[model samples]
Target: MAKYHRIIMNGESYYREYRYGSDSYGEMLSEEELVHMLLEEVVDEEIEISEREIESALRRIPDREDRYLLQNYIRCLERVGRE
Candidate 1:
């Protein structure tokens, strides 16, 4: 038998238990939190885009603020499985 627990941090729920003898698991998150985490961790340059591509794209986007705003939107779309 096993027991599991959960906790919320920064407005997101996280599991506090682990299951042995398996290689699968799942969790849940609010849209806001999911977007934040995915932007911060899940989707980094190493995940898909190469450094050269990122550099090229960065050069094409002139405004720093606009670039950042677009990046945030991209993260949101990715988290929602649209990208």
Candidate 2:
């Protein structure tokens, strides 16, 4: 079974703590995993992103790689919204 983790998202730090699995991808999950799996999945599914969304995400993430990922996700969300 998959284990759940709790993470803080009070407008500051955000991170995922994988539970019920080893850091190496095979160990059992820790009891207090940090990955906010539920919120992440829900937000990803529900957000109807657009070009504006991409821009917003870019603004949120300063790192180039992270901005790329967020923009890609926003594009996918825009496509899903159009569909």
lDDT tens digits by residue: candidate 2, 4-61: 3334455444433455445523333333333444455556456554767657757888
For residues 29-74, what per-residue lDDT tens digits would candidate 1 score against the true structure? 4556555765776455654657588657867998999888878886
lDDT to native, each model: 0.63, 0.56
Poorest stretch of ten by lDDT in candidate 1: 16-25
Reference-based TM-score, model 2: 0.32
List the candidate 2 regions with Cα displacement exceeding 4 Å.
1-57
Give the range where candidate 2 is weakest over 10 consecutive residues by summed lDDT: 24-33
